[model samples]
Target: MTTLQGSAVFSACAQHRHRLDRWWSDEPRALVCAANPSRTDALRPDPTMCRLAALVRHRPGLGGFVLVNVEDRIATDPADLRRWLETADPAAVEVARRDNLARIRALAATAPLRIVAWGTLVPPGPHRDRVIAALSADGRHDLFAFGLTEAGVPVHPLARGPSRVPLGAPLVLWRAADEPS
Candidate 1:
């Protein structure tokens, strides 16, 4: 089996280091998802990633998963970071989103599942909407999402408890508003 370590998958993500942050494992049974990069320079997995790895281990047919974010740059203040990304150069954000989607597609092609865990922090916009849609569009891959927060947003891996709650069906988070409450 081709491992993510030292594989083209890693290379593909590394190439986008200038625009986005990325993380992965050599394991093939990975679940790719989104989050803002932590406020640090280390390339290693952070606490949130460690939590996600633990959560996935409890589920059947999942060994581990890799983590990626909508934005690659470290966000010292994630709340402000979201605002910055929302107002930043639209063209640049679109480019980064496209690159992120491409990387996710490549990883999901081999992974057992992909999770939409960017959470409410990522503002709803055309670019964010499209990325979420693309991640679930490929029927060949099985996509899942964590339980929603009190405000009905998908719970980020770090904010969620360690319990192995059932993963919900793949959802286009932006469209969730139309669904009856």
Candidate 2:
């Protein structure tokens, strides 16, 4: 994954949008679901995306890791993000959640690599769990994550250095039905 260039495909709402999608070429698109959107968009990318881009350069197949989020709202500040998630208008939140999931599904249709890396930002469940369930749905289940964060979710891209090995391995969450409860 060393400097594989491709077109940038960004699907986002207007200025005050709920979510955004920043994707690159189509060598092997991997679906990456994070806690929420930072200040990154098509025009400008934040440090998290920067770190992810560098990390992917070392690994081959993880090219064009498309980023989604457990929460759709964009918030650079953790406190503000949490508040929005908890206090935002229900109708708006629902709309954003649905839009995000639809984009994830559309991307997952072609992407072989799907990862769940929301960290502890998603209240340990709900939004995170919802996204996982959605990814596991439609009978096409395949998910992965780099490493475990302190919150026990997948390790965030920002937390890793290029020295790390392959992107991530398959997760049991992908095989939800096969596992016994």
Candidate 3:
């Protein structure tokens, strides 16, 4: 078994520190949650980040928000991503889920809102189930919202063009039943 320190996952999380660190200083008004890293090794300010930032900028009333992932590890190969999401070891998934939750809670302590933008990419399992439960139980339902795609799944910023986003509108959280249990 590979330790997290020696795994590619750790490297990915470490690389993203710069962007994540900014959240501490800037103190975002919202907290955005996405699925996980795809081909990219680090969670830098990519197009999705840019779009989310734009939302905060153009809509100053919405305030600024930090973006994060439900899973912090990197999925270098698309095929491997599917394997991990669908059938990875339960222990590993639990660890990732726990880390993600901790980060979310810590960040949420300061942020006023939480945004769910994982889209259809987030695989269904106990991990996701627990996350939803935590968010729902956190007593911040008013802060939770989703950015819907054309297909009606929660969407990542880059998934759709900026103009398409209902920027001024309040986002409705996706139904729990819509996701696989």
Candidate 4:
């Protein structure tokens, strides 16, 4: 799995706010909102929205739809996404992912559909962006990578055990268009 840093995500959102805004209004859009909830350092969805707002404000085409649990194939399915969001007493893994969905849904109701990505993080899961890409390949959504950072991008190694991926680095997340599978 690729280790995409939060900083990279943040930078992309900032640099491409205009493109993202435009894409939201005109083209389909999606984001791998979270690689790891603990890694993001965002407890509430407000910061997430703030980051998304930066792009949504500029790109009106960036509809408010995020891909949750981007690291897992089954978790990202449209049906699975709905189940995760609606489930009660979910497992710890589901809880983390659901939290992201909860925040995203809340953001959607409060703000227009601007930012789109998966909000959930499940342990021993695939990389966030990779899962998103898989879903994209499955015709679940679309993406655009017009504005990306040049340095300090984090990369997920997809290792096992309790080792944490290093942070405070730059990372790159590639976006995709939801073409027919």
Candidate 5:
């Protein structure tokens, strides 16, 4: 497959577009949506959701169902999630997952779907196999995760790294290599 590289803004827009096709009503695919806390500004999800929703609103798709969850925090309230789902095309939220099996079972009812388990960590543990098995049983769910590098840099497989750190102009513009003594 071909890969495209661009600025962060471009990448975000591309991600939004890809997710739109996956979760929009016209295509009617089931989704397990989550975001990395660092990568996504949860407070401003409209731009993100709207991009996904617009696909459904504009396209003649089949489903607009999504089981939304947040990374590392299972206590996120469904009611409080309304702001996250605020868009022209709203998605149906599923219960938070304390166990992976339960989520897979919940999603079985909605098959031929795309499952997106974004921004969660399932390290080598007792429950890891069970979660993998649960995901394997369903052909539709596309599970994803996000985490930080050893150096504390936030990373996503889909994104390039090491992530850029914000630097002020005076420092950023300094170029010792180009300086002539």
Candidate 6:
């Protein structure tokens, strides 16, 4: 296999919450869907993205991944993120989500599927549901996960090191948690 290098990108939001997109490596496989953005940007990888890069580097056939989040809100704490998602400006949510699907599809490129890596960090509710529903419809790609969390969501790479989340483990089909839609 040939080694490829990709450029890192950074974008700032007016609200300082939602991020449009960022690139970690040049040869992104498809997408690594996470709960939300941390402090990760063009400069450095947060714990989760760091773990993900490690996992992907060792995983055969998997190259690199572009990080997208269910909730665009940026927070270091998952609890605060959940609260923010529940109460973010409805208008902003619509605007942020407006181009998310297009962004995901564009990032997908020719990949047949996308990996769900948000794990249990993302709370189950309308915000998550809305994104899942939007993507699952009309030309949605298949969803795969390294494994399930104790809560049955995708296993977050940051949940454990690459040792626990082995590269040899095959990706499995994952669906969103059931909540009132």
The best candidate by lDDT is: 6
Off by over 4 Å in 4: 1-32, 38-45, 67-130, 139-142, 151-181
**Candidate 3 residue runs with Cα over 4 Å from true position:** 1-28, 38-44, 61-63, 76-79, 85-89, 137-140, 150-152, 161-163, 166-170, 173-181
Cα displacement (angstroms), candidate 4, residue 122, comes to 12
Relative to the true structure, candidate 3 reaches a TM of 0.65
* Per-residue accuracy of model 4 over 68-102 as CA lDDT, tens digit each: 33322232134554464466354754644444444
At residue 30, give the lDDT of candidate 6: 54
The residue-by-residue lDDT of candidate 6 on 102-146, one tens digit each, is: 565555555534677877766677656666654444335556687
Residue-level lDDT of model 1, residues 132-152, one tens digit each, is: 655555443344566566665
What TM-score against the true fold does each predicted structure earn?
0.63, 0.73, 0.65, 0.31, 0.35, 0.72
Global local distance difference test of model 2: 0.60
RMSD of each: 6.3, 4.3, 8.2, 13.5, 16.6, 4.5
Which 10 consecutive positions of candidate 1 have the poorest summed lDDT?
1-10
What would the per-residue lDDT of candidate 3 be over residues 1-181, giving only the tens digit for each residue?
A: 1111101134353522211321212333566777665433224445655566555544344445565666765553446666766797888767766767776776766655667777677767777766664444455444344467667666666665742565556566664423432
Question: Global CA lDDT of candidate 6, please?
Answer: 0.60
Candidate 2 — worst ten consecutive residues by lDDT sum? 172-181
lDDT-superior candidate, 3 or 5: 3
Residue-by-residue lDDT tens digits, candidate 2, 1-181: 2333433333455323333444444457667777767656566767777766655544566446777777666677778876876798889878878877776677667766666666556664465556766665554565666666544556666655532324444243423333321
Candidate 5 local lDDT, residue 175: 12
Model 5 scores a TM of 0.35
Clashes of each: 2, 2, 1, 33, 11, 1
lDDT of each: 0.54, 0.60, 0.55, 0.33, 0.33, 0.60
* Residue 150 shift from truth in candidate 5, angstroms: 15
Better of 2 and 5 by lDDT: 2
lDDT of 1 at 130: 53
Better of 3 and 6 by lDDT: 6
lDDT of 1 at 162: 42
